[model samples]
Target: RITESQNGWCWQGPVEVVWSNPPAQAGSPRVPAVGLHSTTALLQVTVEDFEVVCKGLYRALRIREKYMQQSLQRFPRTPSQYLRAIEGEVWRASDTGPGTFKHLEGFPLCLAEDLGYHVQMKDGVVYIYGDKAAADRNEPKDLPYPSLERFMDDMNFLLALIAQGPVKTYAHRRLKFLSSKFQVHEMLNEMEEIKELKNNPHRDFYNCRKVDTHIHAAACMNQKHLLRFIKKSYCLDADRVVYDAKGKQLTLKQLFQQLNLHPYDLTVDSLDVHAGRQTFQRFDKFNDKYNPVGASELRDLYLKTENAIGGEYFATIIKEVGSDLEDAKYQHAEPRLSIYGRSAEEWPKLASWFSEHRVYSSNMKWMIQVPRIYDVFRSKNFLPHFGKMLENIFVPVFEATVNPRAHKELSVFLRHITGFDSVDDESKHSGHMFSTKSPKPEQWTSEKNPSYTYYVYYMYANILVLNNLRRSGTLLATQTLLGRKRSPVLQYLYFLAQIPIAMSPLSNNSLFLEYAKNPLPDFHQKGLMVSLSTDDPMQFHYTKVQCELMPSCCPSLGLGLRGPRFSGKPADAGPPLGQPLEQRGLCRQKPLAANTACGCRSR
Candidate 1:
């Protein structure tokens, strides 16, 4: 009886079969004639007898082929399916292979097939096996499989396709499958061997190009697991800098920190050396002889050296540090000092000195830096007197520089500092009078009236004072001192006041026109002026003359010409008529006189 093998072949019935008296031979028989017997009994057969037995053999093959194909219908063509179908053959032949055969090795033939093994039928079973040695011999040396040298490269290629973070379930399953095929523990050991080989100074592993695979493997894997693996298998030296694709050294310190690993040998010496190298690169003048300090150390140094430096020098340091200067220990310095001195007592003195010095010199740069000082003052409530001094001192200097363009900016600055509408009240001060109704130019020229220079100075002083008050957040006091009284006419007056400045050549023509049309007495006007002033002037280079006089030409015939023409009649006029009464002859009331003249003409 033929026993069917798991490999889908039956081989127990007979080793050979013969057929007798088939069809005549087409070609000449061999020196010894051979023929097939009709009966299925051939103890021995030679290659020459195949033709004589061809018909019966062919019939048997057709029957077997039909049977095998029908049996194969239940088996899938997938590697796993084929392996399962052929598992019996592999198990039966396990004793015959070169390797020591165990009854059940549980060798995961499924993975073996996936790795490109072939399945074949032998005896009464299917066999799933591969000749790894043969496969390796056939492949180019550069393309060896299960190779430690290529592992990292393969891992890197896989990693490039994955997004960052945890591995997907599908990928984990695949890894598990791969792990079953090869001895994972042995593979890991091999990886270590490769690492050691690369690190061997005598071997010139760099020339072999093996180290890159390790790096790629480490980077591509789950960072946590990769780090653990690296720590276990390789001696990762923190001092040894690794270059990335960009050619910049990937700081292992940062990577370790990101992984939350307290890296071995991460000492202060290492950090200092790294910092020194970085600093030297940045500032070529930086000397490496003096070891670079950390941020905390530098802060401490600043505090110690602050007193040694004069207030101006200290101020320079503060400006350099800006908001980054946050050492609570050094809070007792003079708040008004040019460099963020925090002492309330020193502010008035600093302010006084600044005011005195400013009068003799025009230092726009120094003036610009004063805002930072104000910020320091705000942080530490130095003194009310100091705040008052700032108002009295700096605002005037800032305002005095104003042309019509600067005046608008100064107005905006005042509004920003005071938190008061720049043009809210127009009755109290000429500073708010930007209207066509402003006092005529002749008024300032008269002896009784203030000179143009005097008014200019007054305007400058008011702007300075108001800005200081605004900076202090004393909006009420600022308004009391500088805000004009509100009036309906003042709205138009304010509109008019802005016209001259708005039309001045120095003003932003488009911006001024925008303001003139919108006429938001509080917000947009101040905002526009402030925006224009602080931004670069080169962008909107309006001449001062145009800004000063454009309002005066409005409401005139020429101005109205751009507006709609008045189509209605005069208010006192009667209804319109097509003809006059005189043309209608209704005024010829002397009828008798008219008749007499006609009779005389007839005679």
Candidate 2:
């Protein structure tokens, strides 16, 4: 009942099973102790259990601290007597020995201060020093995690954190710059001030991805939450806020009202909007209603969108938000477009729209952020359209594509973009034998050999395009090289020509321990300028530590010493013949990886 499959996996009982064979030379297969139950899964499960325990412990400590503070009455004869009574009560209540249920040990005041929170029990009510909800990752900004009542209190805590050291004016950037420059003790004064001002900098965007170079308000903000109005006392007298460099307080609801435009997807409800601190009587009616914010204005902000109206809507918001916030003055931000749809066919029109209405301002000018460009590989002819659009559509200087999949087609494409092949005319079409595939090694006559010809033309044309774009600080390259399986020639050219690379785990690759992650540091060491960007933040299983990724995902996001890899035949005393690694059915360590991406030699 066993069958061999082309992809090296076996199927049985509606499931696919993979067999592993190690130490091929020893005539035996190695079975790891854990088998496919990798260490990564083990660590993830362990971390989750630990976090659950930590969260429960923190909650217990909070309850105990509150109860102890409430026990204090009309000033016990002396402060010492009051403290002693509270300590004795806690010791009796805490049943740490057998976990019948008891208070967890509380952190000292100094510890809380160091962590940027305060725990004080002054009045009958306990006031926490920080946003308690922020500690909970499951809390969504647009939707209350617990109930409406709890979220109101959490919102106040978040706002209070911001109010402590507000950025009232743009006069202090110079000091901030100096602090980040030296980052030493002498600049501690500026460093301290910068820290206070930049806390929750992503608050205005209503999102948490600070690594983003381009942002979209429509993608992050909830129109429903922005328009909701509750009694002033219910929200602690807070209202929806949108920051304007000119000091105009505009809310999502107000922005539409002022512009006199309505998008179709949102439903406006002003009833629950926060009113005065005056507690309402029982006669109040719920005014909150879902408004249609998803009108034509936001429909086509994504890439491959065919609707011109949608594109214009996206463009208008970018301009409107930029103008309102004066992002150029503060942070020099731009718009982002994630285009993976079959939209390369619509490039001419999209480019036309972007060209005529490119965003330009005195302090900042962002061409347009198109981060995902994977669909262009649908045809050999598709990529040149994108290359031409680089100039025609006024694309942002920086863009990224999926790695070099379909090396055969990409070979044709590389030639097309480099101008050796022209747009399909009566004389040239995609099927032309000249660029159908790389010329054979036997056919190689410097200009005819796919190896030499591809290397030469790609370097010549791409270098010109790259150099021009570099002057303006714009770049175009691949996002993930993990599964591309490109030939060694392509790998060498990418490095020699200095193409940018963004590393991301592809389909079926573990974010923590994929073999692809190994190439990242090697790429960097080989002088390939690379960037790490999240492919789909929502899909990844996030932990508190990984959420602030600098600590864990850096250098290598994946797990363990890559299982031992041996390439090619061992060296001998006689002189060796130079042949393709694939030709000899061997692996050789050159340009990092020993195996061809396709796991076969160039035919």
Candidate 3:
């Protein structure tokens, strides 16, 4: 006999049920799909509160999908399909077929002829017009121009949602469920995965391409590597004029004499670039580590890009790092170069440096990192206002995109550049909260620094517009932030959006948090799309294999041999969106068949 009940999907003996809708292609070889096959609603909260949470989450995902599509960035179709189904809309898969790029002599530099578009910056965002007439009429081209007011409204909603008691509790419980679910799955399938991995041929941890998603170009080399480079540079360019002290050019030897130091006497300990106990929870102390032997003169002479020798030494060191990655055959890195918005000319100077040095490596991509030191720049009277600083950071790139031929070097430089990063001390609290009531960027002329969210919103707004214009997408990935205690709503949102997070546990251990305190494992278990990164090898690492050391040392290194396998996952470590598309395969093999749970080719 059958009895009606409030609970759903109870099994009857020897009974079978078929779904009306067929399951989508799994895209991998047949493996037993593990899932919670339940129809009963597991509501931990009141029905009203649960409904509120669901609505908030749906709206949040929609907001992300809207922005991603507007900027031509990638958003996984799985969520989109679910969202569409909820809205009773059909979801069609769009094919972004194999794209191509033009390279000049092995560099991803595409020097297009020209596209005569009038570009101007307003409210800290670049606007493109067809001609002067269009500008006069206040009509810009048909691009996805970001609305600051709308952004502020959305931001405010999210800020409030995260603070809501119901949402927070619901998100915390959900995250806990995901973590427990992942642990159970791991325990049951661990042995089977290992067996599959052993039977697979020609694949192992060493052979897998591991990409260090976040690393600083200035500090890309470790202490020993930097020490070696310093001594070698001193040996080769001792008599070369490498420093300009108020117009008095000093040779490398003379510079060493002025700093009261000898290259021969400098050991890694003496170089003193590594972060130690003193640097823990001290950003200032960590920054001081950029200078060798505690000398800014040495930092300028060696690490800076716009310095006395046109950053020749810096370029050489980066090239050396790239060569090392190339030699390793399966390693890659995206090294960030700083663009302090002291002047718009910084771009041209940097582009010139890049061109003159021919600092191109097949395994290396470049990123431009803007330091949130506008207060420092403004305090020195270097910049008029926050808008000018933003202009210095982004305007030149807009001009290059508008007329590539006019700004050929920067245009080419932009090709090599994959993304932008905002670097700042997160622990420093700001008094201002970003909202519509807050001052516009131009009006933000106070010496006080803006909040982190303020900086991120403006940068994201500009990048959003710029990506639309360039039609070549760039993703914004947060490093070292996700591995900290964050707002539950924000954390859940990150998981839903699958935002790529590059975590540097060792780096965090030295600067902000201890190794045991890092949230990498929790974030990964909750499916936050986390990856391992070596933030600053020079400051945090002792070995030459910097990136490899991070995954190897971390205790909760997810996959056995690969550690954080997400380190090389395409969502986090793929080639730049502008690069020529290779095969649409995650694994480097041809015809990319679906893989087993062990990441081995399924036979």
Candidate 2 local lDDT, 63-179, one digit each (tens): 323222222101111222322333454333222111111111111111100122222211111122344454343331221012223323433442342232221111122122222
Given candidate 3, what's the lDDT at residue 36? 54
lDDT, each prediction: 0.23, 0.26, 0.65
Preferred candidate (TM-score higher): 2 or 3: 3
Candidate 3: which pairs clash?
none
**Residue 549 displacement in candidate 1 (angstroms):** 19
- Give the Å error, residue 243, model 1: 32
Per-residue lDDT tens digits of candidate 1, residues 1-603? 223344332322111221133453454222222332222222222223323333222233222222212211111122222232333433232221111111111111111001233222221112223444544444311211122223233333333323312222222332233234223323334454444445556533112111000000001112232224324322544544322324444443443453454534434453232212233223222222122222222122222222212233223333322222122111111011122323423334443333322211110111111212222343454423222323343333233222212233222222111111111111112223222333332232222322222222222323322222212111111001111112222122122111111111121222122223322222122211100110111112112222332232111112112111110011121111112211110000010011110001110
TM-score of each: 0.16, 0.26, 0.84
User: Model 1 residue 385 lDDT?
Assistant: 24
Query: What's the best-to-worst order under lDDT?
Result: 3, 2, 1
lDDT at 323, model 2? 59
Top TM-score prediction, candidate number: 3
Q: Which stretches of candidate 2 lie over 4 Å from their true place?
A: 1-310, 320-348, 355-358, 361-548, 552-603
For model 3 the local lDDT of residue 561 reads 27
Clash count of each predicted structure: 44, 33, 0
